[model samples]
Target: MNFANRIRRAGIRVPPPARLVAGLALLALTGSLLLMLPGIGTARPLRLNEAVFTAVSALSVTGLTVIAPGRDLTVFGQIVLLALIQVGGVGFMVLAVLVYRLIGRQMSLEDRMALRDSLGLLSLTEIVVLTRRVFKVVLLIELIGAILLWLHWRTLLPLSEWDAMRYALFHAVSAFCNAGFDLFTGLPQFPDGVPNDGVTLTIFAILIVIGGLGIPVVADLINWPRSRTLSLHTRLTLFIVLWLNLTGALSMFVAETLTAGTLHAAPVGQRFGLSLFQVISARTAGFAGFPNLEALSPGAHLTLIGLMFVGSAPASMGGGITTGTFLVMLISMWSYVRGFPAARAMGRTISQETVRRAGAVLTVSLVVVITATYLIAISHSDIAFLEALFEVVSAFATCGLSLGITGDLTLFGQVVIMLVMFWGRLGALTIVAALAMPRRKTLVNYPDAQILIG
Candidate 1:
């Protein structure tokens, strides 16, 4: 039997979750091996830990790095990182399906299922359509972002027009992928200086938001006229995203103003803008113009930790427990408090299965984050507990923002964070499912037991 027939006959199927895990593992391992090569960059061959860490970050699109992007890596290295970002952001399995379609090959049922899971589609047909639409939207958004950035950066870099174009394209793709990789050696600001400019910051913010919105919601908005209604997923995603943005912005603004002694004494407008940008970026976007994490007030740091924990929406390039999962938990809590039979949102009742899945995801995420934070603390006692916790959340959320301590981590700590990033991107559910064995169900019902609750 051929490959397809063999895949069918094994009684073992590659579910979407399995495919995603396998694809990401393969990509990450391959990228790590490539980065280990000598002479690939002007800098020395990355240490094994660094290589693996970078690979995991790129494959997870987390953007956490021990070395600066433009300065440490050569053009070739940057290209490899960029390719990994694109693959990781779009998902390797979805890209395979797209390639199959482009070559006039029909997707198998298994393939369709994989695509559906990767894109969080409810049906195989919808998955196929979503794949096409996602490609178009990503390309259009990235292209537009690149043009705008290029216009802003034309005279800033001491390079030819062609070189400036390349920089613009690179940063644009990085932002839209939520990769957080930048060609600039330091901060992401105007060409002339480190001063935060409205044009650059606004463009980057737009790119990050578009990338984090999740493709399904974008597709719904694009097709709104004909559909006339958004799906439950889209509605929930929008609600959570908007609410988080508003609250996060306000909280950060307040914290920054109250703690202004620790913050650089900037104009109120600039401080507010920085607070907003950092708040949004903390939610899995990973773009940081400033590296002064140590300078932020305790309150601002705590606020960021909360934002990173919540992270981005489901099926988006970015990761975390996900906004949807958090929203589900919140709704479930509200329902329990109100004595409702089931959780509901936006006039629609959420299924018990979804609620259960959300709980499982959140539980596993918490376990991983807490456990990893503890491990890192054991390995690097010099780092503060709060900073370690922040780093753990950042890694697990695939939000690369650090408390100025990532580079100071030991090998064991780096490895732990790498695993966290991988788990975050692939999702706790996908990882758990991949390891679980398939068992045939028996026609038996177990006795129910009630437990006492607090």
Candidate 2:
């Protein structure tokens, strides 16, 4: 067989979860090398560690970085960064399927299964059609966002026409993808951050919200206006998303106002905008309305940590246990408290399997954050416990909102954070499944073992 056929055969033998891990790893490696090539850097080429970390962060669509993209990299490098974010956000499998179709090669059964797993879809039916439509929607949204951003920034920022257009497009993709990378961070004019005017923040907030909504929800919502109906999953996602943002915003505003922190002495209107923007950014967007995060009170920090841990929805550009998983867990707890036979939400019963999966994800995610935090705390003596915890949670959730400690981390600590980001991006359950060995089914049954009560 030819090289391509041989490679395909080998890939087919791997489990879907393992295939996904391998694909992202390979892409990150290639991106790392590309980022180190001549003319990519602003002054000197990136070091091995810098390149690897940047590649992983961008490919995972997590915004944490050791080096500043705007100040340290050339325009070419920024373009490369953008490319990685796009591929990572849209999913490499989707692009692979697209390429296969373009080459007129039919996807094998194995390929279809891998694609289905990547998209987190329950069924394999119409997977190809759905993939095509998803790509179209993603492109359309990004295109529109870029155009609007260009118009908004044309007169606001001091830049030539070409640079203005470039910044607009770059920020548009970064915002819509929930990647959190920003060119404005490197600009001297905006030391803390660019202006957080209501108009700019609103545009970004809308994109972030849409991007964080899972692919299935987005597709479903497209037809909802005509159908005047919604699925249980979509309803739960929407309700939780709305509730979280509102409550988060309110809590943040109260905390900051009481502590006289970031919002101190600011106009009521501006305070409201900053509060909502920060809460929305906490949901995996990572853009900073108030860039001096350390200035926020402990209460505000705690609130942000909670929101980051929750993250965004499943199969979204962002990461977390997902809104669906979080909602199911909440309902499950309520059902148990009420002595109900099954967990229910919005007048529909949730399956036991989904509840179990949510619990597993939450348990594993907690362990990951706790363990990483302990390791980081020991490695960096100067860092505070709360800050370490926050950083670990941010990495684990792929939220990318740091308390300005990313640059101060040791090499070992940085590696741990990178691993957490990778784990967070693929998800705790997916990684567990990928690492777990296959087992054969058995018809045998045994009596349940008795256990002590809590």
Candidate 3:
């Protein structure tokens, strides 16, 4: 038998969940090993915790880091890390499957099902086409983003042609992946004590918005003509994202303006730019123009924590409960308030199964964050409860903005955050589905009883 046939035969006995879990585990392991190579960084073999943490962060497309990227790692090392982020963000297996299809290789039924699950597609064939479209979409967006960024950077930095090209490419990939790794050490605040100008902040914001919007939504928008109406998924994502962006900007503007003594004083234009940048960065992109997280008011910090919890859209480069899940819960709440029998959105009733899944995702994500916060607190009591909670939520949402506590995290704290990042990226449900065994149903049906729920 051919390799595909042999794999098929083996899969006949192996459950789909096992295959999914095995695939993700294998990818994570391979990504970790590759990132650990000596060629990847100048730092001596990384501490076990550091290596694992970096691996998880990159694989999750989270920008959290214990070490500075440009200073800590050589060019070669940065490239390897970037590659991991790209694959992890797009999904390694999904890309591989797309490659096979492009070359005219027939995908086995098992493989199709696995791809469907991984990409969050409704059907196998549709997923195959969607995967191809996603690949094209990513390439187009990254290419255009890189060019625009390069044009903007060329005006700011006086550098050799090659160096400028490298910087542009690196930041472009990082921004597009929603991975907040920055070569510029001093952020929000410029290295030479210069303020972040409007142009740089605006470009970065656009990049973050594009990256955080999920691939499916991007695909739908790209093909909008045929389906003049946007899908519920797309509509909800846009609405939630706009609301959050505007609210976050306004909140930061007021908070920063009021506490101008705490944060560095800037002109009106620069202050607005800084506020917008920091707010967007907190949501999903960890890129910060300013390093003074301690300067923000307690209210701003709390506001950031809330935004991180909401996170980016589903199947996007960023992570969180996902806008879709959040919207579903909102609709469910609205229905209850209106005395409706079912949760509805955009004139369509959400299936009971979808509502249940959203509830499960939210519940599990909250539990993970709370448990991690408590654990971190036990290990590092010096850190305030709210700070610990913020850090945990940042990890769980894959939003890497820290309260200036990353490098100071205890080894135990690092491990806890690493687990959160892993869980966030793989998703609570995906992990649960992977762990669950296949079930066989019997012919007999048991009577159902209603339980009181508050």
Candidate 4:
């Protein structure tokens, strides 16, 4: 038999989840090797671990890094990093399907399923339409952002026109992709290592917020003008996202103000501005308004951690338990306590399967974070428990905010962080489901039994 028939005879099949994980892993490996190639690094060749870590971070769109990208990598290397960020932010399968459509090639059933899973859609009905929409929308937003940033930065920063354009494009993509690769470090104007200017920070925040709103939600929003109605999912996602951003900004401002910490040194209005930017950044964008995160009070740290843990919306350029999952768990718990039979939101009852899956995701994520924290704490004995936990949560959430401990991680600790980043990117439920064996339905039904109460 030929290759295809031979594989069919052998009953070889890779499930969609396996394909996703495998595809991303393969891309990461290729990226790492590319990063290690000559001319990719500035002075000397990059070490294996550094290459691997950077590659994974880029592909996962996680901003944690052992080495500084702008300082250590050449222009070619930065381009590769930018490409990975774009691909990772918009699912690779999305771009693949778009290409296939452009080439007038038909996609197989397997391709459709993979795309569906990648976009986190429940149905495959609008796979092609959504793919095209995502590509067009992403590019348009990035283009507008780049133009605005270029116009503003050219006047403000001391750089050549070409350098200004390049920086604008890079920051625009990074912000929209929620990839926190920045070249402003060590700059004379940006002593804080990030943009403190109102216009630049506002542009970055807007891009980050839109990017994290999820592809499906964006599509729904764009179509809402014509349809004149919003789906329950879109409504709930918007509400919760707005609520979280406001709450996080307010809480961080209060905490830091109370302790006279990082925000205390800033002007009254500027303190809230810093807090708002960092709060927005905490949701999977790693941009910091100030250089020293360690100077923040314990309350501020906790607020950031909580925001990171409950990241952006589902199927967005972010990683965490996700807003949908977090909201589901909260609603489920509140319903149970109120003696309600069903979890309700926005006048709709969420299915039991969704509630169960949310619980599973939360449990698995907690286990991963707690276990990783324990390992990092033990492996890097010099790191304090809170710092260790922050690092673990940041990795697991793929938020990339650090207390200056990323470079200090030992090999073992780095490995743990890498695995957590991978897990966060692929999602706990996706990985668990992919690794599970095929399920066989049983005709027999067992009688319901009482379980112990919490």
Residue-by-residue lDDT tens digits, candidate 1, 134-230:
7878989999998998888787556679767878888788888888767774424434222246788788888888889887788788889997998
Task: After superposing candidate 4 on the true structure, give the runs of residues whose Cα lies further than 4 Å from its correct spot.
Answer: 1-10, 186-190
> For residues 184-244, what per-residue lDDT tens digits would candidate 2 score against the true structure?
7767976877558778899999999999998888877976888899888888888999999
Off by over 4 Å in 1: 1-11, 157-159, 186-195, 261-264
In model 3, pairs of residues that clash are 40-77, 187-289, 187-290, 188-289, 188-290, 189-289
Worst 10 residues of 3 by lDDT: 186-195
Model 2, position 323: C-alpha lDDT score: 79
Candidate 2: Cα lDDT at 256 = 86
Error of 2 at 25 (Å): 0.4
Each prediction's whole-model lDDT (CA): 0.82, 0.87, 0.78, 0.87
TM-score of decoy 4 = 0.96
C-alpha lDDT of candidate 1 relative to the true structure: 0.82
- 1-454 in candidate 4: lDDT tens per residue? 6463565578888788988998899899998999899998898879999999988887788889998877788888888889988988898898888788888988778878988887788788967887898789899999999999999999998878998898899889989988887877644655677667899999999999999988889888888899999888889899999899889999999999999897787888898888988988898888887779998999999999999999889988898999999999988988889998999877799999999999999999999989999999878889999899988888887778899899999888889999998998889877997899999999999999999987
TM-score for each of the candidates: 0.94, 0.97, 0.91, 0.96
Question: What TM-score should be assigned to candidate 3?
Answer: 0.91
Question: Model 3 residue 58 lDDT?
Answer: 84
Candidate 1 residue 202 Cα shift, in angstroms, is 0.6
- The most accurate candidate by TM-score is 2
